[model samples]
Target: MNLSWQTRAQSIAQMKAETFDILIIGGGITGAGLALDAAARGLKTALIEKRDFAAGTSSRSTKLIHGGLRYLEHYDFALVREGLRERTELLTLAPHLDDPLEFVIPIYADKRRNYDHPLLVRAGLFLYDLLAGKYNIGRHRRISQAEALQLAPQLDPRGLKGALVYYDGRTNDSRLVIEIIKTANERGAAIANYVRLVSFRKDVNGKVCGAQVTDELTRESFNVNARAVINATGVWMNEVRSLSADLSDDDKQLRPSKGIHLTVSAERLNVTTAWLIPAIGEKRFYFVVPWEGRVNIGTTDTDYHGDKDAPGAVQSEVTNILQAVNAYFPSAHLEPSDVISAWAGLRPLISSGNTKQATTAVSRKEEIFTDRDGLISLAGGKLTTYRLMAERGIDLAVEQLRDHFGVQAKPVSTKQIILSGGGIKRVDLEAHAHKIARAENVSIETARHLLHNYGTNAEHILALTHEDEALKQPLLADLPNIAAEVIYAVRAESALTIADVLTRRTRIAMLGAAMNCVEKVADLMARELGWSEEKKAQQIAAFRAEYEREYLIAR
Candidate 1:
């Protein structure tokens, strides 16, 4: 019953053989969440991904479990309250994966930015805290200019009018998706990546019954017969909806927007807490947050019309982000060279689905629409609200299953089910990290890194490290990850490619450390998966291409 990585063939075989109660297309966060929720309710569910899980927009996010603080400006209190509620549930659901982090919003008297007025910012924070109600981690407060400078140190001091500190939950976007997928698999959902949906299988009335899917890995095609089919592909939902052939609507479904985020050395642009710097003249703001040992900093939202598969930040975008960061933290003076890695993802804001005229007005509220062929497609949501999105999507599908399709489904609250690698309620994570540090003879940083990434399941990795001394060797001096992580990825986490292992499974690539130890990682994966020299070489080349595709800012 191996669900990931080594079980690709087995998983595919089961998918081809079984007639599923629900078939999910697109393996991003939304699809992954729907799969988990449906399976938990005892539905025979199968999910397929054309590329990899979280390979699209899911993997590329600002990585925050937002409380929707920004929505306060438009007086969208309900959205704020909903996001804050989800934040509370997620923290309890996966503390190791999602945790509270402080944010500093520096105010400058010289530059009139959005919410620059101390009283105004404080009012918004007050609403933000009030909205959180019982779930609030900490109340937002106005800090003295001296205190603000003490916290950030690098913030531009001229005309500084103090700052306001607030709290929000940050996450590893890709890892969270993988965790949910694994949890769903544990609850009995047939899942496979690198499997493309060729087209929808429809009945005489053109209602989708299932789909014709291809194994991208083997170039093999098969028919998956399902009672209900879901399009949870996020940005690609429009393209997926087009698969119904006759189910065509000229009215565009999604108003796609591209956002790019870049990471740099913490030493280069240091911050203990996340910084929410207001992008001057722009109503929205920018985030320069501390992640691992680096600062993840853009996310300029603009209408995107380009290749959806591989979208990278161009030279100007990169320069713009760097320039903004430098303005906020003049002392840092970060250059393009300081950018370790950069990547972009398109937001699936549904055009026809949106009630608001402006695209930004769509925000994170998700919309679900059923095609004439009975294909359910979801669009326009953010990572923070994914769990609720899944719960709602499953609720609709379950109702359709019973009333429309004559199948029975009674959904239980997913809020109760702890995600895979979670459920360490009583144990103190910090204390555990210290204990593992002494036991494994590794630094506290390395121990904490493992615990945060893998949760309680990190024990398997620790055991591997103790079993083999060489497995304990760190991949890079800057990165606390070890060779055991790569081995664990292949054996457990469905890391069929070097990019999956480095980029998402362990996040070694995000830190700009993956390329440094590609040979070692490849060797470790080969040993576990039994790859030949030629195959390994091809994998390496593919990873190199992906890395460049993501990070190479065309000048």
Candidate 2:
């Protein structure tokens, strides 16, 4: 069951022939998690995505698996506790993708803002550690201002009261989603990308029993019958929910806000640990996270009312983020030229009655609502708690299945079921990576990168290099990724388009070499997938246009 275009026809045929126990819509982290949980329970499950997996919000996250330390101020203890628990599970399940990282919250003597006080910040860290309990990666510690400056020399020293250090997890956001989808597929779930949900298919009694889906690539239409349907289309939840017969315009639930991040060279920021600094004037804080050998400074949250498909980061948003980072690290005067790339994603924040509240103040809790037609919709949850959210969604789905379809399924055991490439112990991962590095005749850094991203699956790509020595060549100079990854993506990872491989699968696009290597990568893909010259050119053009629109913000 390859996820690539090679098996698309077979996947569609199977979808039309079988009546799935559960049909999931949306291919983001939420939908991926739900599919994994539902399929793990021995239920006949199928998932359809209008775009490539994680093409939207899932791929454009801040790339942290944190427990939302800032939420402590709101007294949302339950949400924080749940997130910490999930963080622990993810670290164990996908050691290669997720790892523990240290974060430093620099305190300031800002008497005007009570929350910025050193004592209060220390108390918050204590509460954060307490919430993690046994799952705590590292206990929170307080350091003197001198010690803080030694850690982050670029930090603004004036009025710096002290700092608190804590531990959180970080991950490759897009890879995590892809692995989850792959795990679900491995468990007898029929999953297809570029298969858009055209409309909801209801039975004679006006009850939704399946979905009318269309293949976005081939433009072929088909019906997939199922016992229950789920609408997990994150920010576009209302659009999908309205497809149901009973849901109306008044049933709108999502209050999406745009969060944007900028990628800059790590040497420019000169910080090894993550920094949680207060965003200039906002009540919320912004992070200067270290990821993929770069400094990821971001996340400006503001109400967005624009195109949901491509939420481009405006110049103002970029400027605001730059200002926040500069405020913390005054020595690092990062201008627009320093920005390697920028990306924006919508947070499917659940709406509250008080419209005046800041987007940051909005709750990040998950809510599952089932309509009269048995269409289940989920919205407004952070990435860290996705598995828990899935368990809850599947529980509700199982209840509906028993009531309507008389199907009995086993309870979810996702916590115990390790994800793909998760069998190796964390302690042994380094030695295993070293062996692969020696066999592949590549640098230890390159081998470790592959191991970190693909875990045990990295050996498959290494084997391809042995079959063809050319596969060991890098896509571009100075990049560690080998050519075999591109081929592996098409043959095994369901990557159909140049954008899919560059942006999500391998992340060459976000690393500031997308335009430079698009033609070469497209040619490679064309050779493997048998794309015509015109189609190859079209794919390259499309990737270039998207990169310019999303990453190259006008100064």
- Error (Å) of candidate 2 at residue 92 is 0.5
lDDT of 2 by residue, 436-533 (tens): 88877988878988888888888888888889999888887767888889998998789999989999998887878787778878988999999999
TM-score of structure candidate 2: 0.97
Model 2 score (lDDT): 0.86
Give model 2 RMSD, 1 decimal: 1.7
Highest lDDT scorer: 2
The lDDT of each candidate is: 0.85, 0.86
> Which ranges of candidate 1 are over 4 A from the true structure?
113-116, 245-252, 353-358
On residues 457-523, what C-alpha lDDT tens digit does candidate 1 reach at each position? Answer: 8898888877798999998877789888888887777888999898888787778887899998999
